[model samples]
Target chain A: MNVPLLQVRNLTHSFLEGEEKVHALRGVSFNANQGEITSIIGPSGCGKSTLMYLLGLLDQPDSGEIIINNNSISKLNEIQKTQLRNEKIGFIFQFHFLIKELSARENVALPAIKKGEDSEDALERADQILNQLGLSEKLDRFANKLSGGEQQRVAIARALINSPSLILADEPTGNLDTANSEIVFDLLQRLSREQNLAVLLVTHNNQLARRCDRFISMNDGLIVD
Target chain B: MTMSLIGIIFGISFFIVTQAQTSGFQTYFIRTILGTNGAIRISDRFQDMKGTVNKISKDGQFKFQFKSREDAEYIDGVDYPGKIRNALSEFPSINGISEVFECNAALQTKSRNYSVQAHGIRINDHMIASEIENQLMHGSIENFLSDEMGIFIGNRVAERLNLHVNDRVNIVGKKGNFQLRVSGIFETGVSEIDKKRIYISLATARSIEGKRFGGSVFQLSMFNPDNARSVASQIQQTLGHRTVSWQEREKVWLDVFKALRISSAITVSTILLLSGLGMFNVFAIMVIEKTRDVAILRSIGFEPKDISAIFLWQGMIVLIAGIVGGVLFGVIGTYLVSQIPLEIRGIFTTDSFVVNWDISHYIWAILIATIFVSIASWIPARRASKVEPAKIIRETI
Candidate 1:
């Protein structure tokens, strides 16, 4: 009977791909709550990642309402939406999009700094997250110097630096080996249960999706189960 | 970026240095004219009040004032000398005023005779009257003041008449022959003054000419020569006499300077325009290289305006550097130009050319160039801000 941390209702999206109207998402609806991890699994073009992007405020929904922390942000401007994203939402991508020139600490600290946190405080916060993520010695190491698994962990540390309530991760472990993938997945799971954070995971790994607290089955731009 | 910066520097320096030379030339000529002819000259030229400047160009049409003591045709004099002196004293800008009389004379040496202009002045108040003493190539002011019949001759006159200090010469004026001694010789670097102009005591000028030809007029100097026009206009309004400022005496020369400045400005602005274009091109390329970083930043909560600010700040760095470098280079270039000893001399006697180093020009250049560079930078910054993070994220997937 508890209120959900993120609310979505009737999301529909389409795009013009070479003059053909491709419906990426259609009448999709979902909810995520605090302290829970959910997975979205489907074939290659079933709009799993598209739903995650819409939830993250990275793209506009064609006609839908997205509510984060009880605030309906569908009418917010770009600046307001960005502020809301920085304050309440975090994202993890498949490619570990860390800036190569920045060290692990700087990359993690960037989002906190963007939210107008004091830099010394932001870096200190980054250090705390990085250390807990087992990157204590990699604070000063540039993104390129870290291994693929290490870089993914650094990306996770960056996502958690601002202490957002909801994390939308699209295949956070898709590029890792079984051991590294398990390590990264275990961290995400621990964050959800321990911090009471809502997580939406878009993945191709059915086994990993089955292991989450709950999972959604998507097919042909709609949730089938 | 470096090329654009360099272009900005070159344009500003070239404009300032080139304009400095022409500005200096005008200043130098004005100084010479004011030194010898006084800052303002007042003559009872006509009885009209308003059309003085326009009426001056029309010669022989003016009705003479004071008609010569009922026949004072040759006398062009200030009506009340004491009232004029008191009125001039009320003006703090007026430094000093002297009465002057000039007459034509034919001077005969043993070998040749040369026609000359004799300027007569009071021996005591010689402030503005004898300002060119520094140009004395031979003889001295003290020597010129030693005798009652002493004369100051120009260097070219001395050269032609073979006259030196203590030499005797015969002057044929309206009254006939009179004797005088050459006490000094000066070269003013002005051919007209050095060739035929001579100076003598006021008493001697009257005795030699039998008081027939020369008429007294007021020659006033000012504390600041730049205020000469305003002060002269005010005086003319009160006294109703024709007053001529040094600027008015040399309008044709100043017009030549105006032409030179316009040409220099046109040449230099082309360079600055090219720099602005180069800046646009440079930042456009920079945005391309930083597009991925922009996408990442955009996706992670940074506002579009914040991304634009990053690129604009980079452009501002180049703009500031260019302005400082340009001004410094211009000063050095102008100094180098001022160093070359001018081989030929005419109105200005100095060995080197003159340069005006007022700071206002530098400030003006900075302001104008800042607008140019900022707009150039904004185009690219706007492009950077509009980067589509969703499109890039889709591509990566």
Candidate 2:
């Protein structure tokens, strides 16, 4: 009975939209375990990104308990949340937000550098990770020169550089064409399986969602299935 | 960023070089002028009766047309030296005073007659200790005290007459021709003084002028030369004589130097102010343009302080480079400025430009640049730090 990698209990959130309180989430609860990919599918305004933001410790929930590694996060301040975000979680976005000026390897090394690792060691680790992801030849290419699939793979390498237990990827393949989407999905699947890491992916692609180990569907901010 | 660095470099170099040159020129000009001119001079009113007669009438012509009559003769000098010497104690800044007799005479050599202005100074009165000491090229003022017939000749006059220390020359005075020995030769740097002036003992001047009491002028030196005007005014009121300060005697040159000082200050200040503003503009635009990157950096676990440091380091890099480059360029510019030959001919003289190599100016430039650049950079850095990562990431990114 190992502790769950990420836990959310009775999560709720709202926003002020034109003088009206719009509830985004209501009592949404779930657990993502280690070594499993959890797929969350929803349409626009379904609060999937909001849930991702909350679970990543990017925003505090209106009412809920988020526990990472069995340590409660509801009471953490911004500094503590930043430290936790740096050490315990990884993030990937739909657009593959890599700094365009940096090389692929340097992009991957940033998180490790921010975590107080020596730059040389961080860069060496980045080189190893990029090599493992089959970007060995393209390690020195700037992010803008890489194709959609290559850029997304580089983002995955950056996310794995710090060795976090859980990854929150919001629509990781939303902008990719079908062939490249399949290739990136396959790569994520292989990496998740091989690394024994948990991934909570928010997406609208049902075919890819069904490939995950666990599925959670949402509409209007509430869990449907 | 490069523009900002350039601005700072020019600003700092301009400040240092301008101040150094200004100080040097001012010192040189003041020394040249004060070498021959006393800080304050009290000369007897030679034209009092003549001026009154002309002012009361029109051009000394009494419209009343007085019939021919005899007039009493009057001497044109201070006949009471003891009375004036007692009045000088009222000046708090007075350091030394000497009576000088001035008259136009012809220096008669074997085959030449050169008209020269003779200044008769007391060699033992300590007046030459400061004023003439800077201009002494050969022999000493004490030579005049030892030899009653000794005279100090200007280097130019010496060159003209082929005269040296212990050489004898005859001067044709008002009533008689007196033979004199050259005791010392001084070069006052000004062409007027070096070419036409000579110094003799006051006792000899009185004997030649047939006076038993006083000379025409009382030359006074002060510990602080800047106190001349006020001291002149006070003494003029108390002693009833025509008093003149060195500032008034060379008003044109002094006013020009003051204007130069003011213009240099304004120019340097404007340059530094604009440089600081340029730095501010550069960093502000940098922060604004990098909004998306700020969000991305924040999302990657960079705190507000770290983000701010990125911008601060950028500004500091420019500042450090600018300071070092500016100082190097300033020293070189100062040296180059010093090499330029100056051709000023009238009151002041210098062969090449003088540059005061002052270390304090360099320290001052660095300190002021640091303050300006830090303020210019800090505002933008604080702005960068307060950037809301969530808003930019969600909306803009």
Model 1 CAPRI quality:
medium
Model 2 chain B: which ten-residue window has the lowest total lDDT?
B65-74
Residue-by-residue lDDT tens digits, candidate 1, B1-397: 8899999998888877877877777777777777778888877644433322323325667554331212113226566666777887798998868777777898998898899998777645555543757767777777777887888888888988889988999888877677898878877767789889888887777777787433567788888989888998888767766677877766777688788877777777778888999999989998998888888888789999999999899989988898889999989999999998875466656678788776766776677678789999999999999988877787776
**Deviation from truth (RMSD, Å), model 1:** 5.6
Give the top-scoring candidate (DockQ).
1
lDDT of 1: 0.83
The complex in candidate 1 yields a DockQ of: 0.67
Which regions of candidate 2 fall more than 4 Å away from where they truly are? A10-23, A60-63, A186-196, B33-128, B131-134, B137-146, B155-178, B190-197, B202-259
TM-score of 1: 0.86
Which candidate number has the best lDDT? 1
Across A112-196, the per-residue lDDT of candidate 2 in tens digits comes to 9999999999999999998988899999999999999889989988889899888989898998999988987887788777877
Tell me chain A's TM-score in each of the predictions. 0.97, 0.95
